[model samples]
Target: MATPTAVVVGVGAERGLGAALCRHFAREGYHVLVAGRTAEKIEAVARGLKDLGLSAKAVLTDATVEADVVRLFDEAMSPGFGRDPSDLVVFNAGNNRQLDFRELSAEQFEDFWRVGCFAGFLVGREAARRLVPLGRGTLIFTGASASLRGKPGYAQFAAAKAGLRMISQSMAREYGPLGLHVAHVVVDGGIDGERLLKNRPEAKAARGEDGLLGIEAIAESYWHLHKQRRSAWTQELDLRPFKESF
Candidate 1:
């Protein structure tokens, strides 16, 4: 039998969730395609995995661009050698910031939407197009707390996330019976990753042990979602630290 393959989009720092997912899937014996905007970051991730005796390759991709997304799927669906086309794919591209509604520029709002929502749509649509015909595959989207509620300075973020959530929902309902497992994962708290810790050095101390979401732990959930039985598939799952409030 041919070896399986997986594709993880939006990979960045080695310590981030996207990298964690790549590591986990590679460890599980899948040839992984690490896709992200930064050549250095994604290449480093693939090289690191290779050093650890795993199979992986880096594909430079801008998730918001349709052509880039199509090219990525082309590689994923036709990974060379004995590896089978990717049946597991993840859309984990997004950013967040708090800005006063009164001062937020239109460009800023559109930028956020382009990355946070538009990118997910492109990935989700491509996944549906490719995976639905195969009659088997898993496509997961990384969502946020903003997917469920809007806060004072998070209008743009909330709108983007909520839209992505809806896209995931629509895909699940439309394709679940056809054999595609579509899931949306709501990450509800500060991730214990480089982005948060570097920006706020005191975050780990403030949150206490396990107060922030562990990157590996979150990745484990995604793995489970992909492994779930079709008879009992999960369409949506939420992950948060024990101390995080809803």
Candidate 2:
């Protein structure tokens, strides 16, 4: 069998959990596809991986764009990447747009739907079309806590992510019998990085003695779910800090 290819969409050049996912999978001997909106940003991340002598490539792609999404997966299934049908596809798109719902405009709501929900649906649909015929593959979503329940101030964001969770369950039920592993992850714990420092400086200072969950650890969780046999499959996984309540 050919080596597995792992494609991660909406990757980041800065401190991103998805970037860490790329590294972890590559280290495990999977060809990594680092995709994002900007060519420069994608190239920078892919270069870092290539420098480490790992099998990784960067593609400038907008996950929200149908053409881009279709083309990216099509290329991944090509001969160059050794596209094993059983390879993993990690859907890690969307970013939090801080906007109060009381003042949330139609544009804000539409933007959230487009980036968070629509992109995921399109990506998942494309992957299903491509992988179903191949017999088996893993579809993973990197989600947030709000994905489960709607929150007071985070309506738009929560709704969008909730759509992804619903789709995950639907896909899992429909495709699980066909050897497809569909899993949704709720990463409730805060991640440590400069972004954390920039957003919550006080939290960072307080947690100096106790760090947040590392990206590599999170990646391992996804890998664990992907590798689990049907009898032991985890349909959903949620991770929160030990000190966290609720």
Candidate No. with top lDDT: 1
User: What does candidate 2 score in Cα RMSD to the true structure?
Assistant: 1.7
lDDT of 1 by residue, 109-195 (tens): 999999999999999999999999999999999999999999999999999999999999999999998999999999999999999
Going through the candidates in the order shown, the clash numbers are 0, 0
Q: For residue 50, what is the lDDT in candidate 2?
A: 90
lDDT per residue as tens, model 2, 132-175: 88768899987898898877778898999999899999999998
TM-scores of all predicted structures: 0.99, 0.94
Q: Which segments of model 2 are wrong by more than 4 Å? A: 81-86
Best by TM-score: 1
Off by more than 4 A, model 1: none
Model 2 lDDT at residue 178: 86
What is the alpha-carbon lDDT for the whole of candidate 2? 0.82
